[model samples]
Target chain A: MKILSKLRASIAVAAVLILSAVMFVDINDAQAEYGDVVINNYSDGAGMRPVVFPHWFHRVRFRCKVCHADLGFKFQAGGNEINMVKIIDGQFCGACHNGDIAWSVENCNLCHSGKPGTPTQVHESTVQKLAQPSGAKK
Target chain B: MPVSTFRAEFLDTVSGLARGAASPGLALFLWLLCVGAAWAGEWLPLANDGIHDPRSRAVKILQQPREALQGLTPDHAGNQVRWVQVLEKGEIRPREKLFPQTVVQKLDLDVILDAKGGMPAVRFPHRPHTEWLDCVNCHDGLFAKSVGQSKISMFKILQGEQCGVCHGAVAFPLTECARCHSIPRPGQSKPVIPAGIDPRIHQAIGQGQK
Candidate 1:
């Protein structure tokens, strides 16, 4: 009975060490996942959903200076006070995204998908998947 | 019961309960708490003292640049300094280059600004500045990337905007006007005065020549 008690105590200690080790290893892996910035400045109050700006999709095509410097976009998220009126009048994101350059502003659901907790379908890009840090699972 | 006997009995009861009643999952959780407590004890003191704060750490690191440069030369030991010699010798290494190899394309673009009051046009070289600083430092916020987008004026710069951000504090002072205004004199191949020296000293020498 004493030997069995010793075995149980040893097993408990070993399990604790293994669990802590697993937790420590997974912490960094979880943070390495692709991050997206959600721009919801006036969206919710104006009866619209927030725009999810995927950094990976934009970074792959253009340099940081192209949008930030040339287009006069602020560095911080929600730094630029963007509105639908300014966008329609060809300011901010509307400068290039006026149908001819990229996409038209008429497509409402394309940008304003849904609220924070609502079930929304997200399109996964192969470029972003490939760019993930090594040892990160799909 | 004696104190020693009572202590022993208490330990025995606790150990017996741990082995008999407590599950492996509970044991694991308790162990994690103990480990976390120990880690907190080790790190919390240093963090609370502001040593772990990123802003303070960055300030500490940046303060070392002058001292780091001073360590290399004995002649200029504790003297009023200039970094151009260290840069020309290729002794100063940017902190970014010490990291893992990341291919960053360096463009040597020259911007010639026409002087307002008939002073020599300021020839701005991108290569030298880009060697030390990242592009984001000046690109979007300070100066627009698009040509002719920003209205850069000497008065604005004097008021601690644009180039004044670094020049007066870290780089050579704005008093050294000939450094940027590199227009050659009528009879000289060079600018008739060397760059990187105090313009006040140059003016005194010019007065002596006359």
Candidate 2:
């Protein structure tokens, strides 16, 4: 009777763990789209949430030259060293996010709306849907 | 002091020392070299430094283009550089983040532009370009997502507009016609141009007028 009770308790614990895992996955998958980039290089360590950059959102208003050419952002994800310091200094996201062009950086939640522990990377959905390039950097 | 004025005054002072041990002209040359290096250090920062300062240590060496672009795949024509092949072969991998991490998300879509007047269709492959670029690089400004949106013409291109923005300048020169005008149109359906295609391609080829 005692052994059976122990086995039942373990099974109950395992079920809860599995259910929570599924719920956790569902939370991360909540609102991401094709070109959403999750940046968590410093967020987890800094005790803050990761940043999810929406590429299509910015593409609507500005030309590529505004950011990629004029602003000098590289093609690679997490390629540019974007920090709170740099953003505050009227460079990168700061150029537009500085009150006049768009919302000011004072609104932290506007950009840092990402999962807690997501790693820094170009979102997989954007690449996986498309075929990998012939001689892409590994 | 102004460079020209300083040069004139220095030369006047050193004219007496021209026949002396230090070869005054050579000393002036060395001084000018120092000045140039100082300016470069201030303006052109190290690659590891500022984000905009793109100068690399390897690129700073005297023998450049020849030395910097060593050991890469060669192309048969059009600037003689098969960049896709070199990147595929992994001659160099750019860092997405510092300490050598790289991520290249490529899309595999091809947009074909139908040419009129017995011309072959132009196939714009997204793979090679998207391999090194983000979608924002071209969309909404350079070329709209919708077909027939941008007015692309050979005349505009020759004048450094449309595709000419990169092709003639950074990418292969526009002289290589076969590279872009690759796809042959299928027979006899009146060769309808796609909705999003730049109409100038058909107009220019059909009328033989750019």
Candidate 3:
């Protein structure tokens, strides 16, 4: 009788523990929303400016393969080194900024004039909106 | 009276022993049940880690294709590797020293659920899949350490989620099930091909699984 009683007690305890565990299992519904622009810069000894690139905006205009494959981007930032000087010289962004496809180099306040920390300024949105040919009825 | 008392004592002892054995068995069963329950909800770990980052490693090494191939190949020493397939899906493309295209590497798995809720055995191709995609593509972030933890489903796949990130769009279309399934229509029912009687093995060897 004693042994039977002990067995029943142990089984009850095990059942309780299992039931508690099952009941307490946390169901996490947390989801993280990261920004589309992932720019890891590796230039400028004073620490490189973070490139605030809106991927959705650019993706609307160009396919991933264009800049990634054709333009020879290394699939990640800081892999294929890009600098302001290179863009001004028609190497990186300058490839299209020859006054036809994008704003000419004479329009100096385009990409270079930002105060670095401010991701978006009044002039930034204005220039970005006007830069695209989407509005122009060609 | 003494005889009757002895018989009574004997009966009680036997009953006690039976009870003792039963209690232990019951305790063992409970222990096993607890263990099984604990095992049920454990998950595989799939997190993005530094080792998985392809671009970082690829850029650092920047070894020419030939140099990379030469390091890995013994028979094909001094072999010039062609191009690395970024996210391609296909059978292993056989090549000698070098080719116009290199094979992408990624795990190719065929899964079938078994009865009793046990994990189904999976046929996985490890080498070729690694060649095509970057290590970061699946290792840490995509797949968890434990199997079946990802909660991956066909619904998510058709929706272009989870593994769909590459399969339908970048990798081979899942519509081509034969690539992973390998078995012909007649043999689909049997999970494993019997030794010396299977035809798919012959086909795989003949085609080099390309």
- How well is each residue in B1-210 modelled by candidate 1, as lDDT tens digits? 222354356456555555675465555444555455334222112112211222222223222222332333211111113344444455543233312353444568998776665455678888767654558768788999987788988677655468865554334445555567665434544433445544432332232110
**By TM-score, how accurate is candidate 3?**
0.26
Q: Candidate 1's error at B47, in angstroms?
A: 26
Which of 1 and 2 is the better model by lDDT? 2
* Model 1 pairs in collision: none
Best by DockQ: 1
Q: What digit string (tens of lDDT, one per residue) describes model 1 on residues A63-94?
A: 44455544566544566888889888988778
For residues A1-138, could you state the per-residue lDDT of candidate 3 as single tens digits? 987898778777666766665675433221101112323353224353334343323432443444543454443324556766887776756766678766666644233321233222111111222233564321
Candidate 1 scores an fnat of 0.01
Q: Point out where model 3 deviates above 4 Å.
A: A1-35, A38-49, A105-138, B1-210
DockQ-derived CAPRI band for the predicted complex in model 2: incorrect
